[model samples]
Target: MRGIVLFFCSLSLVACQDPAPPPVEGTVKYTNAQWWLDGDFAAGERCAQDGLLVACPAEPSLTIDLEGGFVIPGLAEAHNHNIDNNFGFTRMNPEYLKRGIYYVKNPNSVASDYQYVEEDIARPQTIDAIFSMGGVTIAGGHPEKLYVEFLSQMPAYMGRDFDSLNSDAFHLIATEADIAPTLDLLQEQGAQFVKTYLLFSEEFERRRDDEAFYGAKGLSPALHLALTQAAQARGLRVSAHVETAADFAAAVASGVDEINHLPGYFVRDVATTEEAEAKYLIPEDMANLAAEKNIAVVTTTIISTNFYQDNPEQLEMVKAMQVRNITALKEAGVFLAIGSDNYMSTAAAEAQHLVDIGALEAHEVLDFWIRSARRVIFPARKIDCLQPGCEASFVAVSEDPRLALPLPETITYRLKQGYELN
Candidate 1:
């Protein structure tokens, strides 16, 4: 009986003991590089283990010689539509990773798209993460028109009978009663945030002289306000697509969290006329109000790619206006985030545009792309800076980004989660 009792006691002691922990992933030490941290350079030798930076390793499993390259946190795409157009992800994923853009945000996409990309497709190993806002829009609003128009142009690519897909993907709020249900559906679809658009309808465009037709096509002001309140109540950030002065004012008054696209893109005759001034399209008072409200403006200046290609003079005129508009917004203390909006290759070009316009200096532009952009997309992640606790994600450029007028052409190395991508 004593021997049996001792055997049971030994079993209990063994069960109480903690199990062995899994071995740590191999340590990677990055050496001989000018590491950019907290808006300045830091010590060159930094070690990382298990996808995070740590204190200097006593014996690193692997060491990479950066050859004195400049390292900064990986870039982020604040506003993108890579999933809406099915082929975009396939083409842009590798390119985005190669260019050191590891984080991508798709502000609008269909339910099928989310499942297909997030589950079916094998994402590039280099990509750190993809954040998406499952389709949220107003009935017969901007993106609805935009998507229908695009599908009409490319019927072969987008099936002729894609109405069901659109209906399932885009949550359209036709009236006040639709707001709650739409928000619930969006949440069910795994949306991280809410996206809404304010645009003129086809009827309003045709009957331009009809005073009653204005602002009646999209969600009414009352419905917009309700939508904003409901989304906020659910703890979701709201992003609005605005181009006209009226829409911009409405979006601000409705208390949206972010405003996409700079002013003067779709205002009356702005796209067609060379004399379209930014001041007229975007009122100074409205800009000041947005700044006061702390609403961020994503500089999707690249959305003018089509207009620029058809008319060179118009391009120059628009560029000048953009420069002036951005400068004024900056003076008003408005926070600016960068987004290529389908022109992924032109990320540096967008940054350079801000520099050329004198809205921000070269180094400031880098922060706008790397730091400011991350804050907008990953607000709760707390991984914007390249500090020890942050994820080990950064890109090593051939030339120092701070001293260069534009981004360096050659990316010597790209690291995400302490793993080398290229």
Candidate 2:
């Protein structure tokens, strides 16, 4: 009987032991902190990187004491334009790095672009960015008159002429004929993505001939659809900028990959009027359609709220509309990203705005700012996670943000591509 029992036990042990050695798990002294893997709290978790990551490494060659700090993937800005002017390089890079923002998507940068400042950005110590060199808009659309004409006088844009700016900074697509050439120019300039303007799309034709509407109106409905399709065919993702709910609906119907700004942020044409604000409310059908097509959206609410600051009543009204639009989109399961779209600001500001307005729970907003937003900026890369195969770039905080988000000043460490950055 003893011999039979020993034989059975030996067989069982052999069956369990033949596979392989388990990956080493990391140990931490602090029970209060947890390593965030993508969006989950992972305790006693270890990761390794050889360019890409290997979770729970068999033997990690590197070890840096976290000193009980909490960790999260680096943040991103989905609708930034910090590359729009030559001077932006000197100011934006350090600011973005300090904020733990590792990825920036410039929806519409001016011509000289990243090539002009490769030294500052291409380094592992600096943040990475993708450029959609210029955006396609109507002849006198939103940015054409403002970015090309008036701003050209500024020291940052001194010698750039209106015609050259229109050609290289922002295209003036007066008709369908302009679509192919605009896309061609963008590709030639090495654009990673494409941006199309759709300001008050429902009123495009009506606003076209009105001199008063110049610089306010955007692409026609037909042309908007055509441009999106053409850009996609050329292997570029399209991000549409919209104003009214009608414009939002038009963007969704046009089958664009992303919507740059949430509608109802800024009231165009007739400001402060409830009738005008009503046009800002997104319809359930439009939201549903956007979800069905897997279109992502970036929230650029706070900056637009400045347009109504003088009138508290209208500000509240706009907030109410934003809440409704956000609720509708969330219910439809659309992927929402964090973006300031205000060159002067970063994702942190936008995240705070969402929290202030109760647009999302604090934790959910933090996830968007740190995890989801990075993926939105660069959909193909292995980013925004500490999981196996993810690139090992992360930000370590001294406090658990879920309980209370500490100020940026309190951040203990910021890492990029496995190297600790000051």
lDDT of candidate 1 over 1-422, digit per residue (tens): 00111111221111111222332478878899888876777656877787777787688887889888888887876777643443445555666676777776667766665665664232225343444344555545545554454533442235633375454545666667888887777777778788776654223345333444433245555667788889989998888776555667778898889877776543355454444663235667888998999888888775565555767776666666677667777778787887756533435566666676565788877877886545677776545666678777778887878766324366898776655666
Residue-wise C-alpha lDDT for candidate 2, range 164-225, written one tens digit per residue: 78777788887678789888888888888888888887887789888888788899888899
Question: lDDT of each model, Cα atoms only?
Answer: 0.64, 0.72
Highest TM-score: give the candidate number: 2
Which residue segments of model 2 deviate by more than 4 Å?
1-33, 55-59, 271-273
Clash number for every model? 0, 0
Which residue pairs in candidate 2 collide? none
Ten consecutive residues with minimal summed lDDT in candidate 2? 1-10
